[model samples]
Target: MKLFFQNKLYILAGILGLATSCEKEFFPQPPSAKVAKETTKLEASFTATPPLSLSDAYWKTADYLNIPLTDLSKNELYSDGFLNMTGTFKGLSSFNKGEDPKVMMKAAYDKTRVYIYIEWTDSDFSPEFAASIFNGPNDPLKPDTFRRWTSQGNSDKVALAFDIANASSATGTFDVVGCAASCHQNKMQTATGSVDIWNWDLALSDPLGFARDMMTDGTKGLHDDEGDNLASQNKIIQGNSRSAPIFEWDGTQQSYKRPDGKITLLDPGFYLLNKTPYIGDLDKGDKIYHDADYGCNHCHGEFGGGVGTIGEATAFASTGFAGKYSRASIKSYSASELHPGLSYWQKVPAANQDDLIAYIKGLGSIPGYYLKDPTGSSANIWSVSNVVRGRINTGSVHTNYKVILVRDLTTGNADDVQFLSPKGKSFPFGVALMDHDGKNHIGSLKHLLTFKL
Candidate 1:
């Protein structure tokens, strides 16, 4: 009887163990993702010859370190920009986990430059900047009702932070923090430390082929690196305490054919770049849009473009994807831009053309910024992404981002960090990922980088 009872007990214990293992494998916990094996130190080995191209076959041989990114939307300064979709957007803490919250980083250095490569997944392709579609005419009593931005805002971004002085750790005292040290309350501003920031903005800087080089010092927010700039805000404040984009494509569509035969657009990028300054009267556009006799109200309904589906139609009542019909279905065009494959422009009467365009410009998806190539210290870090160069998978629901950032091994900029000689034997840094957000991000701290000699 004793032997039989002992065997019975063992059987029960085995069943319980199997259940626990199954639960552990299936029902995983949050704040951590199942990713590739992580390496301790990120090593940058010296290479005598290296191709600097983003899609080079030579990069396949480099060793990489995988880093996990966790939820960072709980900071005091973490904001969801004009659209507050925290815990709902596609990332770490979001209910709908879209992207795998992991980054694979690789490093290599030549005689003159250091190259850093990173790859991560993002579900959405948010290339458009801020547009101004749903704004109403200057209303004195309700100025806030018709603000500039809407849900169709936010851009994708990634940033790296390094110690400027002996400030490798976040606080310059304790080595626990990484880039989080720079972020004091809102943006990164330490009480006694400074950091050199390399921000790669998909919308603002990528189109111009550079990461924005910036610096932060004791309690001071982010500022530009001396010499050149990557971009500037193309905003203009109007009478009702609201702002609008100061520029637009002068009804012209310009494009650039890449070496890969990808035709990248250079005009009306949703943001202005080499486009004409905006010259429109919102009141005039609004009047022509609602004119019963000659208005598009017959087909597009009361407000925007589609029949009550678009934002500008109901003054932005309808939501995302530009109200079913989409801008692609009905977009402005020029004879010069017309190709054998398509046509989205209609020849409207010259009298109504300007007014209709003015109203269209008032809608939200307009660009609140503009771009220019960088120079000086700011241009030190040459950057590229798969999205900008038309190197990404066009058919995927959400594509991955493979970015390459290369900079001089020793740029003698007063505001920049130097990685000279044995001093760079070991370096600590931080990285942040922003998914359609300006402030809130998911990142890790205190990642050590070592030189492989």
Candidate 2:
């Protein structure tokens, strides 16, 4: 069955571009926000012959196995290996509801690395705004700003989660239910234990570079457990930092406001924070940081009344002093408040750089820090490329991406799960895709990966 899929991919590679007309209707669409009652399982066996290169030619190799991801809820699974994984993704927030976008995926791997390919249908190719480009919907001249909680102004993203020890032994619900088990009103906050996350964001982590290495330990707190804090908060600051007064729609005019004179609108869009200065006296108050409610706590979790560390203090202040009503005025501040000297809010502090570098080096002795460029360096173990030809749906403009990640089977890093030996070991994993618009995502299905000679 796997060989059939591999052969089909190669055979269709040539005519795949020409078959777009019929490809749109090739897969069945699942209903919106429909959860699967039964668990979906996918298995991948090891192959001695891996792809010779991480390029189009290598992907055509017969050694690479193929699997079709169809509507799991509808039981549309097939064994022919055709690339037919397509379905709509439901919106996570109430503001954007009933949105169901479709996506497809393929995967392969070698002894030292794993490869994944994903393609989703989207009408727009939204990239994260350049530092100079304004991202706010309200003002064209203003600097770019966007919400931290949502992907409104940012680039598209894809994430994969691995359950290290296996579902039965997992400390959290991730092994049994996948990501949905961790998601809650507080943004995927779980009770205990951690899940390894490989998140690829076009803007935050360039395609060719490393995916944002992150982990979420279903902790109840906001500060420690949240994934991708920098990107999320940057969006929040931009979404709230608007030139004109923010307004909300009352199903009529976009002029609704809270009794305390705060903007009631949920999706304020993106704006550049550094471009917008504090209008009032710094000591007295700033409307953008103080008066507005940017919903930073939705993802940041909670940091009690300014912790001792600079990062903790920033998180505390930016989250309106742990969601207190009195601190609502501080919500308008820019992302700079989170990292004073950094051009980007997410940049790691210079003091912490060495520790981070040492940590990455410890991870399989990879040689360089995860943030460093791999080109012309001994740390060039990962190879990534955007797969453009496999896009099938003409109804929308979309993109496909492939990532080749190499690492030692065993990495001594405490946070990292060591593959050790693959002969009898099985690793459980899941995937999520964020569409081009940055509005919706399809996530939370589990797969078991094994390597065999």
Stretches of model 2 off by over 4 angstroms after superposition: 1-58, 61-104, 129-135, 139-152, 165-172, 184-186, 220-383, 387-399, 403-407, 437-439
Tens-place lDDT digits, model 2, residues 127-200: 33221111112222223235111112334566667654332223246556665444444354445655566666
Cα lDDT tens digits, model 1, 283-392, are 76666666645555444556554563222223332222222212323343322365221221243455655555655555534555666656788778777567643332
Error of 1 at 361 (Å): 2.9
lDDT, residue 58, model 2: 38
What's the CA error at residue 452 for candidate 2, in Å? Answer: 3.5
RMSD of 1: 11.7
TM-score result, candidate 1: 0.73
Backbone collisions counted per model: 16, 31
How many clashes in candidate 1?
Answer: 16
For candidate 1, give the lDDT: 0.60
